[model samples]
Target chain A: MKRNSIIVVLLALVCSLSLVFLSGCATDQTVKSNTIKGDANISTMETAKSKAESVALEEDTLKEAALKAKREQERLMAEAAAFKEKDIHFDFDRYDLTSDARKILGEIASWLSKQNGWEITIQGHCDNRGTGEYNLALGERRAETAKSYLMSLGIAEGRIDTISYGEEMPLDPANNEVAWAKNRRDHFLVVSKK
Target chain B: MRKIIALLIFSVVFWCSSAACGKVYIDINSPAFQKFPLAIPEFKDLGNMKPGENLSAWFADQLSSTLKITGFFKMISQDAFLEDQSRAGITVEEIDFSNWSSIGSDFLVKGGFSYDGKNLAVEFRLFDAIEGKLITGKKYWGKSEDKKAMVLKFADETLLALTGKGGVFDTKIAFVGKEGSSSEIYTINFDGSDPVKVTTYKSLSLSPQWSQDGAKIAFTSYKAGNPDCYVIDVASGTTQKISSFRGLNLPASWSLDGKKILMVLSKDGNEDIYIKHLDSGSLQRLTNDRAIDVSPTWSTDGKKIAFVSNRSGSPQIFVMDSEGKNVRRLTFEGSYNSSPCWSPDGTKIAYEGSSNGCFQIFSVGEDGNNLMQLTFEEGGGESPSWSPDGRYLVFSSKKNDREMVCIINANGSDLRVLPDIKGVKSSHSPSWSQHLNLY
Candidate 1:
């Protein structure tokens, strides 16, 4: 019975030692979790402050930003509208310049002569006629014809680049004479400006 | 031992029972052809692989549909078949011909496939059901990924055995499709299945023409902000720019030997045709005319070239020697004629021209004597490319506010859309391929 009591005391010592080690590990985990919670609280406070500040400035910032965006949009629209207003039209299946086309191009030449440090891309278009392959070449010929006239009016050759749309993209997606006339035109777009 | 003896006795009995039935030679060229009643049962998977049934059915469906489109065979409905499965009979010694004969099938095609985890081996046999004898049998072995190619190989052989020449069923058709506001290149099989995307350059790609070997395709793409000529390998999907001149590098045609590519470059301020030596990248300018000279097509013999030129004040078809000599205009009636495609047999040229007020497909002889219009619908047809067999033409038709590819008989009788092709609602500029031995 004395030997049994001694054995029980040793078992109790081992159990107590294991409990101490386990509790030590649990304490360390608790300290780490508390540190994480503290960091989360700081972050939440910072985010709340930022959120409050943004809410306080929302009305004035939004109105000012909207007004500035509208003005910039209008400026871009006016610039694009200027180029669209002066598109040179062509007759059906013909690339030669008409008297009216020549006159409009003369006005365009004067306007181009006044501008500086700007490059224009001459997009040749076709009126949904003929094969895509043939129309492509024909459209290039049209753009070349226009570019040569511009060169004759003293516009730098480097300022003009040409491309052909070949009945793929159209100004009006209609199958009528009026739309075809509008589509068969040399559209001008400002590609680069100082 | 007992099973072997029983099998031998059964085979001998069936052989003697089905010996003599008259043979019939079908003339596919006959205007009023009685389609041969053909039955294709589901293929069997001898190895019992997981996807055996699915692959077998897929191959059988491809074969049946190809045979049906030949216009010479009446593919009997599978429901009319007495044997729902092939029953492991790939050899003449094992087949019970009476079972097929009783079902009223004139010809029968049965096949079996074995998948060994890494590779597939398919065997096909064409039998005269009435005569109870095999006409031809073939076996194809390849990687599992090449299952379609193996099936096509068998189909090609079967077609050759039936008709004196094989069909272009295994070939691909390259065309342009409108995707997300940009045009890209796409390829589809002749049977109208497996539409593969060939290009993703989100720009305008047009006029895709296949090389003579059917290995590469040359087309024009505005990828680098200029219309440049590019060649793409069909198998690897790798693209290389062939020409990037100052203006207009458009693909025109590929020579029969694939050593020369003809294109139109406007570098000289006028669109003119030039031949580029593919190996050395040397160029030979063919036309120096002030008028527009474009859309060049080479004859099958590579001795002559047919093209479109506006030398006559309007676009018309013209022919010249390979070296740009002996030029002759071919078409005079049409106000606008372009896109000339030479037939494979070197007998005729098919082109598109304005008729009345719309473009129509026309076929003219080599000497420019007979000019016959092939399409008459209000919807115009353009880009008439010939099949490898020279018996059909595939072109694009803009009818009823829809753009689709149309395949028509060379004689202009049968007009139909590609049966199972999808995403073709906005496809155009089709080019048919030759009989390629890719597999």
Candidate 2:
């Protein structure tokens, strides 16, 4: 009779251990599936633990998306900056495009052609030597000349716009020839990008 | 003594006959014209109110300065006066004329005022000091704030009595006042009293053109990220974008009938002159040239338009009929001539011409004769606009690296810079308004 009681107690210990092991597996499954379904409900302790794990996984996903979007915005801004860094200059009181101006405009046209949904505005500027009104019209001619060149290079006309700031907004405010050479030019600005 | 009295009577009759036939005491158009010497003493306190602001001297100074700006009268020194000014009579019947005559004062202005802190009543008398007779007199009742207006009105009457034409005291000069990167439209009195900001666009506003009726101001602004032409009502402060073409919509002038505006537009891939009807919003292309055309100004009679174009290899002034035919180049001397402003009489056009690497103001007859250079300053002059009476031209000039508003007679005499307004760094593109009917 004593031997029979010992065997019965050992069997009871084995059964309780297996039940604990089975619940452990069940909790692991619930955590994985709850991450997908966004619902965690089971035993009280298991529910709480699975909810925490699912919240962490969602946070990771959101952080990854935000990082991707930020990177894209930075890339576009860099591209626009690169496009606007170069300016094509003109002679004093003249708007005809020089050979150097044409070469630079060709490069701009190529870049703009590669850009899928980008648009740019060409700001024509002038030196402060002439009357403001006449310089205004001269600046317009400079911008229009640039626009026509870009269009000739297969860039869509709708992708280009022009404005003449006259002598009002000079890149260099000095009253010398060096500053004037820098002031009278066509400056590019990216208005839109995909 | 009887012979002296007879001579006095004869001279009085002579003066009366000349004045009755509208004889001008000063012929401002003559190249050898002289400034009329005038004397102004401290105003007498007729009301004897408690002294606060010393308005007796203040009113006298205001009247003196107002007359001084017309370039017509010269103020005599008070120290040179032989009379006891403090106790002198303001009327013709009570004073001695020999005191002013000995001082070589051709005219005398005497004022009496009563100020009770807020309201003011003033009396002014302009005298022919040589003849010892009153020429004109005025009495005004107004608030203290209207003191300037009152003084200006009396000065206007005095000018009429002297020149047979009124002064531009009630007129305002609209100009582009630049602070930093931004520019706005501002209006100052012809005498430089009130500086009012007409635009708060916070962007680049240029070339303010006042309408004929003094009710609206048209200009070009980059407010909406584009250079668009807009008109603002002077009374309501309401703005309307009249032209928003794809590129380059600049206002040049307004029609006398207030029904249309002349502007330069570049929608045709080239800058050209265009007229926009205010009622129908329909545009009439005035010039369809391939060259750059800008700065269109209408004649007073509305029969012609003056503009600047580069079709002749350099920018020059050209005149065309109102319908854009009969285009004639008016300037052949300057390689770069622009900013053509038609005179009030429609006989001449004033413009800025480049000379010795600097710009100068010049006026040429409509028939392309008698080219006269108006300004010879080293800093140069530009953007000339005529006064209502056609006696003066207001333009922008630089002095000591500071941009200022300057006035010169049509004959290139009496070049004076208007006093600068505090905190204003630069002012340009002055458009003198028509005579404002204000009391």
Candidate 3:
């Protein structure tokens, strides 16, 4: 009787095993644990990347503002330098530097001496009594005179360029003497060298 | 004694032409001046003149052309008078002004030339046809070429005595003749002898006017890309652009005082007249009209200006104060009238008039009355400038096979063509010089 009972239990256990296999029921512990680990690693990496990017952007904006402020300060300084009184003049049909003109040019020479890497242009003008060609020649002479004067005062020769405007770009249009006096002048402009 | 002096002053006022001192003056506005039928007695030649070198005959041709083109005199045929050479220089001895008057002439022009080694002295005398007296006389001492110049000056003097202003015969005129696309500015003797090139820019140039002092010429040149007003020194050949604005710049008349340049500028969006200070380069806007106001010419006295505008949809002449105040319309006739030039005497203004699709030279009084058409037919005239004496006008026109420079009398009589250097398609704008050679 004991042997028959043991045999019936064994068969029942076999039937249950077959039925579970046929239904394809199984649980994967390694896959579920691997998915959970994968999700945690991805979120942690994304958070770190966003924090680094935000810090870099903030640093870039701070650097940009500091550069702009420095540039504004330099512009204001240049304006103050140019604002001092300057009176460049010429003789009749001559570009030769007079004592008075050189005195005014002396101030420019000292100012230019302070700043390195600054290139400048000297523009000459003339009155309207003579022919246009003659006035142009005269203007060129005047500009060169100023340029040479600046060079004589120990300024580097390559630092200054000269140009002539002739009578066309007059500072005054009056036909009287006062207007002509104002028209015959040389002005300066700042430029960058190549 | 006081009564006698008062009577003398009264007679002086009553008979002005008859009033004589060491010099006798003729009435400039003499009523009979419609053309004093002057008899230029076949100018007598002095002995042994070389063939084709009959200087006096050349003088007669020049003088006849000068007077006849003036619309003032009919050169009565010289066939009625005798020609003698041996006694001609000293023998004005035979000219009977009464005989000329009897021949239906109102004046007499006679010339005598004497060569005394170093210089040839030519003397000329103009006679009053009715007053029966020598109105004025002059003597010139120079070379053969100088003698021609002398004769022209004498013609001018005669015209001046008759009209109270210098003749344009001695003045120089500048014009542009374009053959194909190439153009050049040429200056010719009023009789058109030396049609010499003033500018050979190889580009377009136009609107030339002499400076008030006659030392420089202001014109528009395209040599620098666009049209800009350039002033060239007459003697030095130096060029300078006075009005090289960003847009079109053209010369009008120079101010009478020789201080400012009155020209047209389109820099302010539309073309307007601007008075540019020559020295200070200051520009003062003169007119604010939205219409295209161009071709500004100052009045002779410098009080007003006249220019062309299309504000009414058709081009007409308008006059305004020099400061651009109180503008008024001057031409109610014709659709296209432009390039107005005031007479030197300030009596009339000459402009090219277009009507029925053709252009003609027309003159109108400053009062806008007496509008007379001074040209006829087709291929019309442009840029009519008055001779210094206001008797003749120089304008560009087509004659024969090509376009040539023609001088028409203000009365529209005796249209004569200036010498066009073998009669080629040459000449136009002809800004007459302001009476040079006074020195």
lDDT of 3 by residue, B1-439 (tens): 0011111111221222322332424443454435567877645554444445566666777778767766667788877654343444423345545666877777777766655554566666677766666666666666654665666667777776776656666567877665544456667777666666767797767667887776778887768765678888876789888988755577778886677878887675456888888889899888887666777888888898888776775557888898999888888897667778898888778888776655688899888998988888475776788776676788877543345678876667767777746323445667877766532
Q: Model 1: what TM-score?
A: 0.75
**lDDT computed for candidate 1:** 0.79
Model 1 agreement with the true structure over B1-439: per-residue lDDT tens digits: 0011111111222221112222235556566756678888878777857652467687789788777765567787888877636454656777677777888898888887876775567777778888877766666666666666666666666666666566777677888886535788888877777788888887888889999889899999888988999999988888899999888898878887788999999998899999999999999999999888888999999999999888888889999999999999888887888889999899899999888878889999999988889998677798899999987888987754445787877777667676434543477789999876444
Worst lDDT run of 10 residues, candidate 1 chain B, spans B1-10
Q: Is 1 or 2 the stronger prediction by TM-score?
A: 2
On the 0 to 100 scale, the lDDT of residue B99 in model 2 is 93
Best by lDDT: 2
Cα lDDT listed for each candidate: 0.79, 0.85, 0.69
Model 2 chain A weakest lDDT span, ten residues long = A36-45
Better of 1 and 3 by lDDT: 1
TM-score, every prediction: 0.75, 0.84, 0.60
Model 3: fnat (fraction of native contacts): 0.00
On a 0 to 100 scale, what is the lDDT of residue B255 in model 3? 81
TM-score of 3: 0.60
Angstrom error at residue B183, model 1? 1.6
- Flag regions of model 2 displaced more than 4 Å: A1-79, A191-194, B1-21, B50-53, B115-119, B399-402
Residue B10 accuracy (lDDT) in model 2: 12
